[model samples]
Target: MKDSNFLKENNARHMWHPMAHPADSLANPPKIVVGGDGVSIRDIDGKEVLDAVGGLWNVNLGFSCEPIKQAIAAQLDALPYYSTFRGTSNDQVIELSWMLREFFEPDGLTRAFFTSGGSDSVETALRLARQYHKVRGESGRTKYLSLKKGYHGTHFGGASVNGNANFRTQYEPLLPGCFHIPAPYTYRNPFNETDPEKLAQLCATALEDEIAFQGAGTIAAFIMEPVLGAGGVIPPHASFMPMVREICDRNGILLIADEVITAFGRTGDWSGSRHWGVKPDMMSTAKAITNGYFPFGAVMLNDKIADVFEQDTSGRGAIGHGYTYSGHPVGAAAAIACLKETQRLDVAANAGARGAELFAGLNGLAEKHDLIGDVRGGHGLMCALELVSDRAAKTPIDKATIGKIYEATYEAGVMVRVSGPNIIMSPPLILTVEDVQKIVDALDAGFSAA
Candidate 1:
């Protein structure tokens, strides 16, 4: 193997990482992951750590998913690359579309529009939402609404609707007519409401108020992650999504479920919307679609939206948006293998079981460590630990303190994610009881060091 120092130096000098300052990479060199097996990753320094983050919450089947690997190789051998754009389509994409229709049947999504990844999927859904309105002669419906602290991707349209300032401050002058409502985040909310049910009702009311203020006739769609991911795994109350769905229906607005992190058995259900017994008008899915083996995603459309596009005779239904690799055969093959294995193993049950264990462990850690201000989880495998300097004041821990805890956690043999003052974990759904314990042990050690 090459010298670890040499590799680190080169990586620091040559690469700029996403969601990080380029200069900071040199000061705190990132761990160079060399290889992965099952739920563990080996860094260039030759230390193996339990990957509690699941490769950015996408590697649902873990690193050693052989069937998916084989499928990709086989697809490459047969047909390396092919586009599913206008005037052309591939057999792999056609087969995958049928499979997706059946898979997302409960969500009422009957058609799949392929994209390159989650961001592309969000862009497609947003554009299609507007076009759907145009097809029905409601061109005035051009506005969007979302929950504050919700993350949708980084595209112009997605970023415009995104509620987090961290992702939008620098890219100002984004698309207009995008607004936000308060999320049902019980930890820190403007309502000062601690009860989950009350919080859900308040947030839903806020959504209704926003629509009234903005005029429902001018709104195109309401997009949100059923369980907010990158904004810190904030899962809403059981009543939240269903209420939002009813509100959108009454307002003549479409609902887009951004299931990038909570789809395909991640939330102990096929889709997060199903977890709450709500079917969205459109669903943006990616991340685990191909088990993170390939860059692929799909924006699913329900029958109502499909009918509008299908029955349009005004030439407005012709899609003017698509990526060159929208439906690459290789990605489709990988997705097929992933879907089969996901259903065969029934990872959702395991996710629920292991998630309970993980959540309990995190709650235990919170009791032991005063730094842990809040522990959030219970929906499925996704969880987060928000750190604070003072429990009463809820003062956020500084970056230096978070860095110390992160390094200690890495040294203790578990790799989690640091998002602001939150330690997020989205371990592979295939995790065993032993794996869950190891992650807790690592975090315990990290808290001790901090």
Candidate 2:
């Protein structure tokens, strides 16, 4: 291997990372991951740590999934590239589509549209939602509503509907007709209600109010994450999604479930919509679809929406949107192998079991650490710890303090994500009980150092 310092210098000089300032890279060099095995990753400096972030909440099966790797290699050798744009389609995508139909049947989704990644999936769903309305003669329904703090993706459509200002302020004058409502976040909410069920009701009512204000006929869809992932793993109350579904049904607004992070057994269910027993009109899925092995995604359409396009005699249904690498054969093959392995291993059961332990461990840590203001996680492998300088006032911890905790956690042999004041954990579903314990121990040490 090349010298770690040399690699770091080159990376600092030449590479610009996502979600970071270019100048910050040179000041604080990012860890250069040399290799990964199972749920652990090794840096170029030879420090191995348990990966609690799970490759940005996608790698459910861990790093060394050989079946998917072999499938990609085989497909590359056979048919490396193909576009499913018009008449031409690859056999692998067709097979994967069939599998997706079977998998998403519980969520009432029957048709699949291929994309290159999560942003593509969200954008596809957003466009298709509007198109569905237009095909049904509801051309005025072009507006969108989403929850505050709910993250869809970075695309224009997704960003317009996204609730976070940090992502939107820099890119001004995004698409109009997009609005946001209060999220049912228990730790902090506009309603100031601590009860999850009551907050869900309040948020649902807010959604209803927003729909009424926007006019039912003018609204295209209500897009949201089942359990808010990037906005800090804020799982809504049990009654939340079902209430939204009822409201959307009454308003003639399509429900778009952004399951990019919560799909493929991340939330201890096949899909987050199914977890709440709420069937959305369209579902945006990616990330875990290929276990982070390939950049691929799919937007699933319910029968009602699919039938509209299928029966439309006009060319309006003809898709004008698609990526050059959409339905790439290698990605499709990797997804196929990933789906097979995901089911064979039954990672959902393990996620649920391990998630319980992790949640409990985090809560225990909260008891010991004054900096931990709130602990959130129970559904699956995803969890978060909100740090506070003053627990009584819920004042967010300073960046310098957060950096200290993060460095300590890294030194203690675990790699968790720090999103603002939140310490996020989404370890591979293949994690054992001992692995969970090790993560807890590492966090314990980190909190002690802080």
Candidate 3:
């Protein structure tokens, strides 16, 4: 079985790759990553590469964290599988919920609904939003508002609400009534405004105007990523998030902060809401929650929604949504340990300090490289380098050029993600300033190749 072609043949015969054409996947045979320790991943060929994107931007504590592994193992030994359905709950689940509530601080959030991953978490949020509206006798409030270029998850509902066309092109005729408006992206400002605060106001005004045109009564919720992770890592415009909160309140609409990517210190804060001073009515979180140690996601509900269940409108009307893996004991244990390790290690602060260094490095690169059209990402550990065809015109580099740069970067031994012509970076929070310099150096080399 040591043959180089053995696993490739076996995989081609049996396994189907996600998000790829069959012919292309076979031709580019997937690199089998054998192991991960700290911020480094070892491929089957035994070559070591740094995990710049934290293994899909979920491994907040980096790879091979012993405490998380130990916690999962101990939970497996004690009670590997259990459900949080009906009235039954496990210690890990209960403790994790309380810990989350405490961490979030004196918010009105009263319950935590668990799911398998980010997509399911979005599904859960959509269902719960519908239920909450129904309980309040506002059943017609079925429409949702999300941001253009925003990515929630890949589920039917999530994808429908998400505004990225590339992800939803194949699945046309998605769920109806999901509308989109421009998010607070300063880099590609539609209004061409220089002031970040002014740009945010303009965007927020657009949202309010859209709500009015759509009739706020028909809209149940407005969802957005506080940091806009997938849409080229666009952080909110200055003081823009708080304005959204005000708009939602004025219109009696639920603000759902899809922190699935921004939660658990990705933004150098407990939640992106805290970073932006936006208190969302409902918050969906996952990814870094367990540091990718186990599959888990959660939606925290506010007291206003919780009150509906207390009135006893039906037979056991307790939110009335769940998944088979909801509140899995092992997942809960992993979350508990992961959260503990995050706090003990001060991961948020690490992200904050490291983010400053990363931003400076990228900014310097932007100044040096004409192909680098723009760079963005605030006080969080998120950054994106937009490649361009012309420096003075700020024109985006062509698709073919972007692909060439991406391939060149990969060949240069750095794994960076390409979203359109933008090379996005959300490296592991544990990265030191020196590690960030290395990533910048790799990007520089990739640029030179272009």
Candidate 4:
């Protein structure tokens, strides 16, 4: 039996991949990654490919960091798992919480609740937002508002709160009271302009209109990513977040910053809020927390909301929520290691520099490729290339053409991500200038072929 066929057969028999059709995967089997080191992954066929997406926008410290591996191993040897439920705790979990607080350092960030990953983290934030209002005697505030094209997570609450229609259409009847408004997408602004500040104010005005339409009293919180991640790598318009912050404050609504893909070093800052100069009442984070070495996520809350829980909860009710692995010791240990590495290596600084290089490189690609409609990115090792059949009208490539570009790029040995008709490049924070150039070259070649 052929070696490739043997592995493919095994996968066909039992494996089901996410975001992919089983039949399609079987016909063109998934690339079986066997190992990783630095910013590269090795397929089972021994082909080395640059990991441009950081394993779904995690892995900030990149493929194999000795410290993270050692930390996890040490934790496994000492205490593999421990629950943060019912008042029991572990040293790693406790320390990691404080560490995150230090990293964020925003006013009112006083508590941390851990989850296994991003979806759970989103759920945690959603629940906390609803409960905060309830505890404050504003139980009428049950509505959540997110931005257009935003992605929170895959859970029912998150899916409902999310504004991307494609992710929510098939699973309708999602949690009621979720709403959406226009995002600060300057490239394709509803009102056309290149001025970031003007675009920002316009977007904020749209949000205000939405709130007026729904009655702001019914809104619990407005959730968004400071720098859009999976949706399109779109950054917030200039001063957009500051204006949004004021809007939330004025309406007495919580601001939930979903930094699942932008936390840690991704955005050249510990949190995307800091990167964008916005202050969130609470933040949802995962992906980079453990640097993709382990699965972990967390909801960091400010003092304002934690105070509500402190008062008179003894008789009214328990908080009534927590995952079994809420604060897993192993995940905590890995996160601690990852944080230490981030500080020691200054990965955020690296990302700041690399992001500039990457953006310039992709923009350079735009000058060469007429198929490239737009290139968007900033200090986050994040980028998006919107493909277009007509540059002036900004008409997107047909789905078939996009699939061909995606497959061509993958076959050319660069693993990236695609959203809608746009290609996303989120190279890990550890990438070097040369690594970034390789990615740009591959994308250039792929676009040329497609």
Top candidate when judged by lDDT against the true structure: 1
Superposition error at 392 for model 2 (Å) = 0.9
When summed lDDT is taken over every stretch of 10 residues in candidate 4, the lowest stretch is: 310-319
What CA RMSD would you report for each candidate?
Answer: 0.9, 0.9, 1.9, 1.9
Q: Could you give candidate 3's per-residue lDDT for residues 291-376 as a string of tens digits?
A: 99899988988878777867756644566678989999999999989998988998888999988888888899888879998888
Q: Per-residue error at 39 for model 1, in Å?
A: 0.4
lDDT of 2 at 295: 98
Error of 1 at 183 (Å): 0.6
Q: Candidate 4: what lDDT?
A: 0.86
In the predicted model 3, the residue pairs found to clash are none
Screening candidate 1 with a backbone cut-off below 3 angstroms (N, C-alpha, C), the clashing residue pairs are none
The TM-score, computed over Cα atoms with residue i paired to residue i, of candidate 2 is 0.99
Worst 10-residue stretch by lDDT in candidate 1? 1-10
* Candidate 3 root-mean-square deviation in Å: 1.9
Model 4 regions lying over 4 Å from their true place:
1-3
Error of 3 at 64 (Å): 1.4
Residue 390 of model 3: what lDDT? 88
The TM-scores, one per candidate, come to 0.99, 0.99, 0.95, 0.96
Q: Candidate 4, after superposition: displacement of residue 56 in Å?
A: 0.9
